[model samples]
Target: MFEQAYGRLVCFADGQREIIAMQWKQGATCAVHDHGATASGRVHLVVGALVEERFSFDGQRLCHTTTLHHVAPCTIEVPPGLIHRMTASPDATLTLSIHHYEPCIASMRIYDPEGRRTVIVPDDCGAWIPEDAAAIVAIEPWSAP
Candidate 1:
């Protein structure tokens, strides 16, 4: 389970004209389980590592899992057109100043995969829902959703 959270800054699609700041603490993360809406997404990390776990959804089925670890002061880009699942590091206290330079909307969904059903938590909300991503996918890109 994610015992640590993430800090976020949002940028629009047309250009960098918006600066929306969102932050969370330990044992928290965006539970929407998603990624950007384009082929390229960029972010300037100020602090903290954002732990992202990737997955493949076959419409009615969710396949594979990959856990990506990203530290602060770093820029992460997901290849254009890939459905992604992301989460913040569950390590400890950390912070990140995200400068959304290229206009990317990162989303994530949280659930207890080992539980009874699919628990898809929407974006813009923070919650602690941890499942072993490696148990579902094969590669861990180590970035945010």
Candidate 2:
């Protein structure tokens, strides 16, 4: 079964684990964010292509670590607390992927490098800031690699 959640499709969910489906339009990018500290997951790209930016967060600053370009038919293991952002390849009409999380993500921390701020948001918001935007929890600087 599937339902909508955080602008994506929730393929399945139980208190301990969940699977989500994401669709990306050409040139679309998700916010930089980390899966909850206790959650670990894998992202399986089913179609199209994507560009992924990985980051590291020290207590005081967020820093870009590396970037990767992935084509479809690939899988990425997401370590706990890994911070990253994903963008659909500009040449792709659509990009699709499935994400599986254990202990299902309860909340996530989104980083805004340009604004130098970080916000704690509920899982329903995915890696994006919600329209209400009353969830800011930290203000920190960021640096590029």
Candidate 3:
């Protein structure tokens, strides 16, 4: 039941900061993919200590345990060109606050478990926008296409 809200983080180009209430259901998981330019150099935290997994796919199964980053409110500085994926364990149940420095475009992609993939557009996902974005449009997830 972790919900999103506005935070203290400030976005220079996009304005203020906003939080997204993502309910990583008991068994629900986010697709594996490196962050976009927005999160390229951002540092994030594992506020709720939820269980998850990180993995790599270079024609082989390379998975890693989701390390417990006890820094509840720590920042994560993600470098560019980092390929990774994650999945929520059955115990995950918290809100995710992703602080970005600018507007997200279509550079993000989802690594599908079914072997199908597609580009993830910010307007479509509505996860990278501000708290009060206008004229928004949702892009279809690669799950279908």
Each model's lDDT: 0.47, 0.79, 0.40
What is the TM-score ranking, best to worst?
2, 1, 3
TM-scores for all predictions: 0.52, 0.86, 0.48
Give me the candidate number with maximum TM-score: 2
When 2 and 3 are scored with TM-score, the better candidate is: 2
- Per-residue lDDT tens digits for candidate 1, residues 31-130, read 4344334424454556666776666754444455777777776876655544454454567465554434234333333433434233333333333343
Per-residue lDDT value at 88 in model 3:
35
- The digit string of per-residue lDDT tens for model 3 on 56-110 reads 5454343453544323465654456454543334444563445453233235544
Which regions of candidate 1 deviate over 4 angstroms?
1-20, 36-39, 97-145
lDDT of 3 at 61: 40
Quick one: RMSD of model 2?
Answer: 5.0
- Span of ten consecutive residues with least summed lDDT in model 1: 136-145
Candidate 3 — what's its lDDT? 0.40
Clashing pairs for model 3 are 4-21, 32-85, 42-76, 43-75, 43-76, 43-77, 44-75, 44-76, 124-138, 124-139
Residue 63 C-alpha lDDT in model 1: 58
